[model samples]
Target: MSLQDWTEAELGIHGRVLPVMQAPDAVLSAASSPVDPADPETVRLAADLVATMRVSPGCVGLAASQVGVARHVFAVDVSGHPKARTVHGTFVLCNAVVEEATRNEKGREGCMSVPDLTGDVKRASRIAVRGRLPGSGEEVVVETDAFEARALQHEVDHCDGYLFLDRVAGAHAVYARQTYL
Candidate 1:
C-alpha cells in the first residue's frame, strides 16, 4: 500500500485534523514547549498532527505549532518520496532534538504552514535525532540520511520556531513551489 493509503487508515485517531497555522501567526513563530510524552493529551495531539499532515497533499511532516499548539511535538513520514534514502515510516515525536548532525547539503524544502513558498535550505545530510515516543514515553534515537534527514530537520526547526525561509541560502534561493508535483 502507498503512504497515503496507510495514512488514510486511521487506527485510533479521535480529534479532528487541526488547522495549519500560516505565517505571521505568533504561534508559528514562537518556540514550542515540551510536553509529557506519556500524557493522554500528547497522544491525542500526535494523532491530530499525523492526521492533519496526511490530509495535506504532499506534506511529509507537521509540527505542533503549525497546528496552533505550542508544543515540542511533531509527526513525520517519508515512506514514498522520490528523494528519500532513509525511511522511518510514520512517527510522532515529543521533545525532539537533533543530537548530532553532519555533512551540510542544500536542498529544496517546503512546509505545510508556508504553503506559498519553497526554499533551498542548507541542512545536515546525516542526523541523529532523539525524542520521546508519544503514549509510550520511550525515548528513540534515529540516525538517518538523505530526505529523511531533511524532513526531521524541518520539523525540528519548526519546534524551535525556525522556518525553511529563515535558513534559505539567499533571496535567490527561494522559489514559488505553487506547482510542486
Candidate 2:
C-alpha cells in the first residue's frame, strides 16, 4: 500500500530520529491525545507505523513529534525481548502519559535519533500509561514491564521535545556505535 500523503510525514535514518527533542522542556504534558478506533486517519497512521516498523529494522517505535507533528502518537513492536516475542505486540497510543514511574533505575539506552551511540540513562521500570488506542477511540491504562514501559517513555519524550540522551544522568557509561552518537 502506498503510504498516506501525510502533510507532516518524515523519516528517521540509521538510528537517529529526525527532530530529536531535548530534555526537561518537553518532558511531560497533560494534553489528551485522542484517537478514533474507527477513524480512517487513526488506522492509516497505525498501518503506516507498522509498515515503518517492519521495514526499518532498528525502529522499535516512533512518535508523531519525531516527524514534526506535536500530536501524541507512537508505535511500538516489542519483539526484541524474548519474553515478549512469544506473543509480542505492535501497538499505538495517543496523548499518552506516565501517571507514575515505578522502579526507577539507570539502564543503558539508545534512540532512533542519536543513532549508533548509546548511553546509560535512568528510566522507570514500570509505567501506568493512559492513552487512546488507535481505531478504538477507547482510553485504556496499560501497566507494562520495564522494556515496554521504556519504549513508551522514549516516544512520549519526543512529543514533549525531550530525547533519551537528555535523560543520561552522568557521563555516558558504555558507548555503542559511537560513530553515530
Candidate 3:
C-alpha cells in the first residue's frame, strides 16, 4: 500500500504501522485510522493479518506494520489456551486503541522483522482495546492481558514507531536465542 499515493481503493489500509521493513515500525501515536467498514480491501487486510498469525512461528499476533503497511491495524489469534488448540480465536482489528491500560507486566517477545532477537519486555497487565471491525461502523472492544496484552502493546507501539528491541529492559533481558526459521 502506497501511503503517499494509493487511494482508498488501491490500498486496503487507511494507514499502517510499519514502513519499509516488511512489517510496521513501532508506533507512538494512539489515534485510529478512518476505515470504511464495508470496503473489501479493508476486510482482506484484516483477514491477511489473521492468516499470518496462524503461520508465523512463536507468533500469537501480527500488526499491520508486519505486513508492510503503515496504518493503525493488526490481527491476533491465540485461542489455544497455551495448551489446547493453539490456534482458535482469530481476530482482525482495525484502527485500534487501548481505552484503559493498567499496571505493568514483563515477558519475552519477538518480531517477524527482528528475526534474530527475542527478549523480555514490559507491558500492561490488562488492556481494554477499542477498534472498528473492517467495513463496519460498529466498534468492538476487547479486554486482554498476558500474551494478549504483550501482543496488543507491541502492535500499538508500531503505530508510533516503537520496537520491542527498544523496550528490552536490559541487555540481560534481551536474547538472541535461536534462528529457528
Candidate 4:
C-alpha cells in the first residue's frame, strides 16, 4: 500500500511515548540495523516513534535511534509546516532509503535529540524515498519536495547514525537554540 493509504491503527498496537535520546549518546551515533517491517516488535516501535514525535513540539519526524533503538525505522509528518509541500501525512517506514535527492538548499534544522542546538545544513529540496510499511510490509515510494523532503532526509540520516550537526558546513553554521521548542 502507498504511504498515504497507511495509518497507525493498522498496526494493531498502542504506542507509548518513548524518551528521546540525546546527542553524544552511543546509540544516536551508531548505525541502525534493518528491521523486518511486518514483525510485531517493529510495528510497535513504529507506533512508539509516532507517539513520541506527536508529543514533542516542533518534531516533524523521528527515528528509532532517536528513541534509543538502533533500528532502521522512523515516523514522519510534515503536514502543517510552513515550508511543507506534498505532505504524506503521518507514516512509518522500515528500512527506508533515499532513492534520489536533488535541489540542495541550506536551511536551519533542529532535532529533538539535540535540543540545545540548531544548525544550518544543506539538504535536498526534492527527494524520492523507498521503504516498507510497518504492519503489512508493503513497499512504497514517496516523492516529495520542500519541508517534507527535508524531514524525510533528516530521519533517514538518523537511521544512518548521523545528526544535523554532522551535516553542517562548519562550526559557524551551528548555533545555540534561543528558544525551546
Candidate 5:
C-alpha cells in the first residue's frame, strides 16, 4: 500500500510514549541497526515512536535512536505546518532512505532529543523517500516538498546517528532555544 493509505492502527499495537534521549547520549551518535519491519518487536517499536511523537509538542518526526533503540525506524507527520506542502498524515517507516533530494534551502530545525538548541541547516526542499511499513513490511516511496521533506531528512539523519547540530554550517548557525514551543 502507498504510505498515504497506511495507518498506524493497522499495526494492531498501541505504543507507549518513550523518553527521548538527549544529545551527547551514546545511542544518539551510534548508527542504528536495520530491522525486519514485520517483526513483532519492530511493530511495537514503530507504535512507540508514533505515540512519543504525538505527545511531544512541535515534534514533526522521531527516530528510534532518539528513543535509544538504535534501529533504523522512525515516524513522521507534518500536517498543519505552514510550510508543509504535501502531507501523509502520520506514518512510520523502517530502514528509510532518501531516494532523491534537491532544492537545498536553509531552515531552522529543532529536535525533541536536542531540546537545548535549534540550528540553521540546509536541507532539500524536495525529496523522494523509500522504506517499509511497520506491520506489513511493504515497501513504499513518498515524494514531498517543503517542511515535510526537511522533517524526513532530519529523522533519517537521526537514524544514521546524526543530529541537526551535525548538519549546521558552524557554531554561528546554532542558537540556544530561547523558548520551548
Candidate 6:
C-alpha cells in the first residue's frame, strides 16, 4: 500500500495516540534496536508514531524511542511546512540508514521530548535514506532535500541515542522557545 493509504487505514484502528516519552527518560539516551519490518508490532508502532506526531503542533517527525520503544523506527512528513522545500507525504521506516548526506547547514530544530528548547544544529541540506516499510518488508529509498532532509536526520538521530542538543554548536546555540498567541 502507498504511504498515505496505509496511514489512512491504520488511523481508524489506532486512533489512540501514544504518549511522547520526554527528555530525562533513559530510553531517549540509549540506542534503539533494529526492528523487523514484517512484524505486526512494527505496524502498531507505525500507527502510534503517526497518531502521536499528527496531534503534536509543528511536529514533522517522531522516532520510536520518543514513545518509549527502543527500536530503529520513525515516522516523518513535511508536506505543508512553510520551510519545506521537498515534501514527502507521511511514511514510516524501520532500520533506516542514511545512505548519503551533503551540504551541511545549520537550522533551527526542536523535539517533542525536549519541549522547552530549540537549537541551531548543523545538518545536511540533502540526503538519501534507505529502509524497509513496516509490515510490508519492502525496501525503500528516500531522497530528499531541504526541510525534509533535516527532519529525516532529526528522527534518525533519535534511533541512535542523540538529540538535537547533542548536535548543537555550543551552549549559545540553544534558545528557549517563545510562547505567543
Task: Give per-residue CA lDDT, model 4, range 16-51, as digits (tens).
Answer: 999889989999999999999989999889889988
Better of 3 and 5 by lDDT: 5
lDDT at position 151, candidate 3:
74
Residue 10 C-alpha lDDT in model 6: 48
TM-score of 3: 0.73
Can you write out model 3's per-residue Cα lDDT over 60-164, one digit (the tens) per residue? Answer: 667666666556766766565473232325566677778898989777787776777788987887788887666553578777667667677787776556778
Worst 10 residues of 6 by lDDT: 4-13
Residue 48, model 5: Cα distance from true site in angstroms: 0.4
Candidate 5, TM-score vs. the true structure?
0.96
lDDT of 3: 0.63
Q: CA lDDT of 108 in candidate 1? A: 92
CA lDDT scores, all candidates in order: 0.86, 0.61, 0.63, 0.91, 0.91, 0.89
Query: lDDT by residue for model 5 over 53-148, one digit each (tens)?
Result: 999988999999998899999999998888898899898999999999999999999998888899999999999999999888999898999999
What shift in Å separates residue 76 of candidate 5 from its native position after superposition? 0.2
Write down the worst ten-residue block by lDDT for model 5.
4-13
Model 1 stretches with alpha carbons more than 4 Å out: 1-12
In model 1, the worst 10-residue window by lDDT is: 1-10
Across residues 51-154, which tens digit of lDDT does each residue of candidate 6 receive?
88999998999999999999999999888899999887999989999999999999999899999999999999999999888878788888999999999999
